[model samples]
Target: MKVFADLEEFTQAAGTELGPTEWLEIDQQRVNQFADATDDHQWIHVDPQRAADGPFGGAIAHGLLTLSLLPRFMHDLYRVDNVAMAINYGFDKVRFITPVPVGAKLRARSVISKVSALDNAAQATLVTTIEVDGAQKPAAVIESIVRYAS
Candidate 1:
């Protein structure tokens, strides 16, 4: 993991490449739970037996479920010290390029694309590319922003 001395150090790292962190499997249990939480009980995501003959050949995770792993992915990448708060400002653009099937291992690589000053904070834009093990295309690409207040 890369550790920055402070906000200035972090903001100066505009072209920094953070990680292709350890992979985490998208298990059926996790997918089912996400489906339950989101009330998206789609057969392709929840019903493993029925999904066996479906398009993906088995149950798959919801796109949002894969997207939601951003926090987990970033936690393994880098950190900045002495920040009082780091708030998720939301995404600028998001694309679900590949379906995440159950039992597939997923990991992410991040780039610190830009950092701009706010009145009481520093806003950073990270380009997070999530990849599925052995897949040609990324599972998702997200441009996420965060505001760091010290």
Candidate 2:
């Protein structure tokens, strides 16, 4: 994990790659829970038996399910010690590049793309590329913003 003493230290590292987070397994239970919560009971994501002969050869995770993991990924990726609080600003861009099949291990490689200092806070934009284990293409690429209050 990368630790920054304060927002200033973090801002100084803008345009630098913060590196990849720890791997997380995408299991059926997680996918099912996400599907139930979102009411997205798509066969490809929930019905494992029927999904066996589907396009990806098995049940795959929903794109949003993968997207929702950003918080956990960021938590494992880095931290700024001097910041009193951090808030998720929003996403500038997001793309689902590849399917994440059940049981696949995923991790995110993050780069601090931009940073701006506000009156009482700092905003950072991170370009996170989530890669699936052994896959040639990333599962998703997202530009996420966060605000840190000192």
Candidate 3:
């Protein structure tokens, strides 16, 4: 993991890849829980038996589920010390490029994009791409914005 001493250090490192986060398994239980919480109990995501006859063959994860893993992935990738707090400003661009099948293993690769000042705090954007293990394509790609009180 790369540590940025200040905003200047982060800004100067544009296009540099920070870290590859640990892989997370996309299990049915978690998918069901997400489905239950979101009230999105679609067969493609929750019912494995029924989804086996659907488009993705077996049960697949919801696109939002993969997108929601950003914070967890980022936490494993890097950290900015001495910050009073950090807030998720929002995502700039987000795409679910491919489906994450049940039991799939995924990890994130975070690249430093831009770091600038947002009022009294520092705002940074990280372009994160989540790739499934042993797969040729990425599951999701997103540019996440975060504000940190320095």
Candidate 4:
């Protein structure tokens, strides 16, 4: 993980690549829990037996489930010390590029794409990409925004 002394230190490092975070498995249980929580009970994501013959050849995780991992991945990527608060301002862009089949392992790498000043804070946009282990394509790409305050 990369540690910045403060938000100002973080702003000066634009285009820096933060990490390919520790691998995380996408299991059926996690997928099911996400489905139950979000009320997205699609057969392709919840019904393993039915999904085996579906387009992806097996159950796959929801795109939103993958998107939700942004925070988890970012925690493993970088940290800014001496900040009183940090907030997930929002995402500027997001795209699900690949189907994340059940039992797949995923990891993320992020680039500090842009940064802008804020009152007692800084807003940064990280272009984060999540890739399925051994896959040719990334599972998702997102421009995640965060606000760090002193």
RMSD vs true structure, all candidates: 0.8, 0.9, 1.4, 0.7
- Candidate 2 structure, TM-score to reference: 0.97
Model 1's TM-score against the true structure? 0.97
The Cα RMSD of model 3 versus the native structure comes to 1.4
lDDT of 1 by residue, 36-85 (tens): 89999999999999999999999999999999999988889988788888
Runs of candidate 4 exceeding 4 Å displacement: none
lDDT of 2 by residue, 1-150 (tens): 889998889878788787688789999999999999999999999999999999999999999999999999998889998889999999999999999999999999899999999987899999999999999999999999999999
Q: Model 1: runs farther than 4 Å from truth?
A: none
> What is the per-residue lDDT of model 3 for residues 1-150, given as tens digits with 9 covering 90 to 100?
778776545556667786688789999999999998899998999889999999989999999999988889888888777667889999889999989999999999988788776665788888999999988889999999988886
On a 0 to 100 scale, what is the lDDT of residue 122 in model 4? 93
Q: Which is the better candidate, 3 or 4, if ranked by TM-score?
A: 4
**How well is each residue in 1-150 modelled by candidate 4, as lDDT tens digits?**
999999789878788998889999999999999999999999999999999999999999999999999999999999999999899999889999999999999999999998888788999999999999989999999998999999
Ranking by lDDT: 4, 2, 1, 3
Candidate 1 vs 3: which has more TM-score: 1
- lDDT leader: 4
Which segments of model 2 are wrong by more than 4 Å? none
lDDT of 3 at 66: 95
